[model samples]
Target: MNLHSPSSTVADADLQERGGAPATWLPAVAEGLDIRRIFVAFRRRFRLFAAVALAVLLAVILVTLQATPKYTATANVMLDTRKERVSNVEEVLSGLPADSSAVDTEVEILKSRQLAERVVKGLKLEEDPEFNAAVRKPSGVKMLLGGIASLVGAKAPNLPQANSVEAQKLHEEVVDAVLDGLSVKRAGLTYVINVNYESDSPTKAAIIANKFAELYLLEQMEAKFDATQQATTWLNSRLGELRGQVQTDEAAVQQYKIANNLLSASGTNLTEQEISNYNLTLSQARAQVAEDQARLSTARSQLSRGSSGDDVGEALSSPVVQKLREQRAAVSAQVADLQGRYGERHPEMLKAKRQLSDIDTQIQDEIQRIISNLQAKAQVSSQRAAAVSGSLGGARGTLAANSRAMVRLNELQRNADASRTLYESYLNRYKETSTQGGLEQSDARVVSKAKIPTSQSSPKVALNLALGLVLAVGAGIGAVLLAEMLDAGLATAEDVERRLDTSYLGAIPLLASVAEGRTEAPIDYVMAKPLSSFSEAFRNLRTSVLYSRLGEPVKVVAITSALPGEGKTTTSICLARSAALQGAKVLVVDCDLRRRTVNRMLEAEPEIGLLEVLNGEATLEQTITLDAPSGAYILPLSKSNFTPKDVFGSVAMDKLLADLRQRYDLVILDTAPVLPVADTRVLAPKADVVVFLARWRKTPQHAIEAAFRLLSGTGAHVGGVALTQMDMKQQTKYGYGDPGYYYAEYKKYYVS
Candidate 1:
C-alpha cells in the first residue's frame, strides 16, 4: 500500500511481501464502481470531464476540417511461388501450414527499402510542397534566420548559390515523400496484401497503385528467374557427372562377368540351370563313391575270411564301398524310403522301385566309368605327383600354388563388385537429379497481382481523436488531484476535529455576503432562510456545547481561533444573537484587548467598557452596555490610556466577569487569535469552552496545531472548529454529491 518506507517500524519489503493477490484489486475496484456511487462521483465531476471531452472533440473536428482531403486507392496482391511443384503439389509443402515462412518473406519484401524506392521513383512525389515542407525544416530555419537579418539589421551576407543542388534535392524529396506516403501490409491470413496510398490527385492515386503492382510483380518474377537460373547451373554440373558414372557402372558389371567366366552362369537363365545340374551331378557322384566303398569293404571282409574277395557281394560288405555298392545293389534304398511312407504294392511305390533300379544302374555305370578313368588317370597323376614330390620334397608345394591362384581370382571379384556398386549409386543419383530438374512446382500461385497503393496506413483520425480524449481526461483529473495535493488549507470536518480536539459543534456555509468581494450583515442567512444556515447551525452548536459533558447547563462560552480572518469574531456575535433570540439574556465581550475588532462590528458606542473596569476605573454594570437588540449586552474595549493587560490580569477583572455571569444566562467572549496574542492564553483560565474557527482552504494546518499548543492549559475545554469556505469541486472529487451522503446531508443544514 505504501510505496515508500517508513522511518519507524515498518519496512518497504515487509509491506510488499504481504503477497498481494493478483485479483485482489478487482473486488475493491468493483465496490468503488457501485452504480450509484460511480454515477454520483461522475456527476460531481461531470463538468470537468465534459469540458475536456468537448475541447478535444472541437479541436479534432476543426483540425480535420481544415486538413487537405486525402483520397486513398488500394490494390490487392496475392503471392505466387513462381515455379511449378516438384512431382506433387503437397511434396514441396509437405506437412507445412498455409502460413509458411515464405509468406513472411514476401511481407518483408513489400516493406523493403528497395521496393519503397521503386514506388517513390515511379510516383515522383519528392517535389511536392507538403512533403518538402515537412522534410526541409532545418533548411527553412536557416533561410528564415538569414532573411530576418537581411530585413531588420544588415544586408544579408552573400550565401553560396545552389540552384542545381536545390533542383536535384527537390526531385529527391519528391521520391522520399512518395515512399513515406505508401503503406503495404498483409491484411490477414489470406495471400492478399492491401497496398494503400494517399494522394491529393485522384488520378495519381490509381496510377501509383497500379505502378506498385507492376513493380512488385516484376520484382517477384525477376527473383524467381534468378533463383531458377542458379539452380539450373548447379543441377547441370551434377547431372553430367552422374551420366558418366552411370555408364561406368554399366560397363563394370559387364566386364566383371566376362573376366570371371560368369557371363552365362551369373545371368539369370544359365545360373538357374547350372545350380540344378551341379547339385544333380554332385548327388550322383556321392552315391557312386558310397557304393564303391561299400563293395570294397565287403571284398576286404571276404578276403579276410578266405573267401573270394573279388566277388560282387564283397563290395556290399565294405561299409565304405557298401554305400556306393547299395546305389548299384539289387537291394534298393529308394524302395525302402518309399515303403516306409507307402505300401509296397501301391502304384507310386512300385514306380519308385523301378526308378531306383534305373538310378542304381546309372550309378553303377558311372562308378565303372570313374573306376576305369581313375585306373588310368590316377596312375598318371600318381606318377607326376611322385615326380614332383621327389623334386619339391612335399605335397604342400602343389597345394600352395592352387591356393594362390584362387586368392588372385577372389580379389578380382571383390574389386569388380566395389566398382560396380559405386558406379551404380552415382548413376541412380544422376538420373534422379535430371528427372527432378524437369519437375515443376504448382499449388502456390499468386491469386492476386501486386499493385501500388494510394493510401497511407497510419495516423487514423478517429483513433487519434479517441487517444486525445483519453489523454485530456487524464490530464484534467490530474490537474484536479494536483490541486488537492498542494492544498495548504483546512481540508475537512475530520481535520477540524483533529486540530481542535473537541466535540463537533456544527458548520456554517461561507456566504458571498460574509467574505470575499463584499461585506454584508452577518445575519443575512437568518433574515433569508433562517432555518437552513443561521437557525440550524446555531441550534446544532448549542446542543453540542450543552451535551458535550452531559451537564446541567453551560453559562459561559468563549470564541477564538488559531489566527485572524478565521471568522471567530463573527461566530461570537452570531452565537450571542441566536441565544438572545431564544429569550436568554446574553452578554458578549470584546475580550481581545490587544486587537479589538468586534467592538466596531456591533457599532457599539465608544464609551467606558470592559478595559475601564478591568483597570479599576469603572464597575462591571457601569461599563457593560445593552446592544441594538435589548436582550443582548455588549461590553467593548475602553480607550485605555495604557495597555490593558495589567487590568485584565488583575483580580478585579475576575470579579467583573463573575458578576456579569450571574446577570446574564449566557456570556460570549470574542478573544484574540490564540497563536498571535497571549491575552487569550491568559483569559482561558476563566472560560468554559473555547470555540476555534478554521477557515477551509485558507488556514494552514500547522497554524491550528500551534493554536492548540498555545491554549493547552487554558481553563476552557477545546471546542471543535467551524470550517469556512468549503469547495464544491472537492465534494465532487470525494463523492459527496448525493443527498444521503455526509456532504450533502451537512450541506442541507449548513449551505442550503
Candidate 2:
C-alpha cells in the first residue's frame, strides 16, 4: 500500500513537530517521452490550430488574386569568337577575350546605369507612367490617405518637377526602374548571354530586350571604329617623323665620307691596293738581297782561303773561270812531264813552267772578277729592298688613316639603315590601316531576337496556392506548440504525478444536468444518486484514502486546494457521506474560520460551530449537526472574528482531533485554500492524511505545487491529489488516460 499517513505510533502533535509527512511512493511511468501525450495536447487545442490555418490560407488567396501579372521577353546574344577578318592588320581595339571573366564583365555592362539611361531615353520611357512614378496616377489607397490629410488641414506632398531639388532624383528613379525590369546573365560555361525584360505589355518587353541587344552590338562597332581612326592618325604623324629621321641619317653618312675622303672604287680603296702591291714587292726584293749576299759571301770566303775560286759557286758557273782552270791544269801536267823527261835546266821544261804560271795568274784574276761582280749585284739588291720597304711603310700609314675614318662611316651607315628600316615598316602598316579603316565590325551578334510572350510570367496561381497551403500548415503547427507551452493548467491525472511529483488518487467527475434539466450541488447530488458516477467518484476517493495509509488507517482526511472556489467543501462533504454510506462512522469539520462555506453548503444554521467548540464555549455534541440523508455528522464553522491560525494551531484543536478520531471511523476536514489562509496549514499537521484538491483543467500547476509545499511544511500526510469538477463530456477529447476520459464509454456501469 502507498504510504500516505504518518506511522500508527506517531501522534498528530509529534507530526506537527516533525514538519513534514512521510515520503510517499511516486509512479515511475511519470517520466519519458509519450506520443499519446503529444496527441492529446494537439487534440485539446485543435480549435486554435484550425483558426490559425484558415486565416493564413484566406490571406494567401486574397493576395494572389489581387497581384498584377507581368510578361517577360528574352533575347540571346553570343560573343562571336569566330570573327571575320577583313584585313591582316591588327586593330588598336582588340575584341573581348573568350573567357568566363570577360563574359561576366559583359553581363555587368549590360546592366550598367549608362546602358539603362540610353535604353530609357531611346524608348522615351521617362514619359511613360509605367516607368515614371511622378507622372503616374495615384492609387486608390493613396488617394484615400491624401483626402484624409486634406480634411485634417494637411498639405499634399509636392510632386517632383524639372527645376525642383528632386529633378535628379526623378531621373535616377526612372533609370532604376528600367534596370529593375531588365535581367542579364551569361549561360553556363558559354559565351552566350541571356537578356530579359519584364513589363505589363508583351510588346514593350520584347522591344526593350531587342533594343538592348541592338545597342550592345552598336556600342562595340562604334568603339572599334573610333579606335581605328585614332590609330591611323597616330601612325601618320609617326611616319612623318620616321621619314625625316631617315633622310637626316643618310645625309650625315654622305657628309662624313666627304669630310674624311674615305671614298672607295669598286668597293675597294686605292690606298689599300697600293699597300698590297708594296707588300708584295718588298717581300720579293728581300728574297733577292738574301740570295745575292749568300753568293758574294761564298766567293769571298774561297778567295780568302787561297783556293783558286774553282770551288766557289759563282766561279763554277762562269765559263771563263772554267776555261782558265782547264788551262792551268794542262800546263801543270806539261811541267810535270818535262821535269821527268829532262834535266832541271832544260829549255822545254822552262817554257812549260812559264805557261803554268800564266794560267794560274789568269785563273786568280777571273775568280777576283767574279767576286767583284757578286758584290755589285748584292749592293744593288739591298738598295732595291730598302726602297720597297720604305714605300710599303708609307702605304701602311695611309691605310691606317683610312681605317680610322671608316669607323665613323660605319656608325653613320648603321644609323641610316635602322632609320630606313623603321620608316619602311611604319609606311607599310599605315597603308594597311588606311585601307581597312572603313571596314570595322562588331565582335558580338544576336543569336535569337526576343519574341513577344504569349503568357504572363508572374502571379502563378497553382504554385502560390501550394505554397500558401504549406505555410498554413506550418503556422498551425507552430501555434499548437506555442499554446501547449503557455498552458500551465493541470488537466489529467498524469499531470498531477508528473508536474507536481505527487500521487494521483482519482478524478471527481463534474455533475451535469440530466434530461429533467434539474441541477444539484455535488454533495447533495451524490447522496441523492448513490449509484451514479458522481457518487462512485467519492467512494473511490474514500477507498484511496483508507488503503493509501497501509498499516495505519486514515482516521482524518483534510480537503484543501491552492485557491478558493475549488469545491474543497463539496469534496469534504461528499467524501464524508461516501464513507458513511459504506457503514463507516463519518464526521465533517469546516476548519475555515474566514469563509465557513460548509455551513452554507449543508444549509445548517448553527449559531456556534468549530470556533465556539475550540473556545470551549460549546460542546462537540451541541456544535455538531447530522445530515439525515447520508447519516453523516457535520462540524461546520459560523462567522468568526478570531484569527484562524490561533484557533487551528491551538491545543484545543489538537485535543478535539484526538476525540473525533476515537468517536468517528473517518473525519473529513474542509479547510481554506493553503495560499490564501494559514488555517489549512495549521490544521493539516493534525490530520492523518491530507487530500490536496485540484480543479480539473482549472488549477494551474504552480498553484498545486505551492499548496503541496505549505501542507508538507506542516508535516501533513498528503494521501494524493484529487481532481475535482472534471467534465467527462469534454475529457474524451483530451485522451489523457484519466478516469474521466473513459467515463462516457463506461457510464453504463453506474445507474444515474
lDDT of 2 at 484: 63
- lDDT by residue (308-423, candidate 2, tens digit) is 67799987888998888788888888888889999668999988888888888888788788888999999999999999999889888877765777778889999999999999
- Per-residue lDDT for 69 in model 1? 67
TM match of model 2 to true structure: 0.64
RMSD for each of the candidates: 21.1, 27.2
The digit string of per-residue lDDT tens for model 1 on 1-752 reads 11112331142233235432111112225447555544543554567767766776677667765777676777777764344444532221122135657667666776666876677666655544555653445586788986786575444243334445665676666667676667778867766777766777656766776677777777755554555556556656765666676566556656665765554432244444544555565555555555555545554455578743325452334455556455545446657766898877988788877777676665555445444543454455445544543444333454454344445545665656666666566555444444543333332333444334445434468776787778777766654444443454544454343323344466654555223343556654443445544456666676666665455466777788788888877777777777777787888888877656776676555678776776677777687777655357788886544473455567886887788778888888888888877888777667676667777657775576567666665555665666644444354344232211354335544544
Pairs with backbone N, CA or C atoms under 3 Å apart (clashes), candidate 2: 20-715
> TM-score of model 1 relative to the true fold?
0.52
Q: Lowest summed lDDT over 10 consecutive residues: which window, candidate 1?
A: 19-28
**lDDT at residue 408 of model 1 (Cα atoms):** 50
Error of 2 at 209 (Å): 2.2
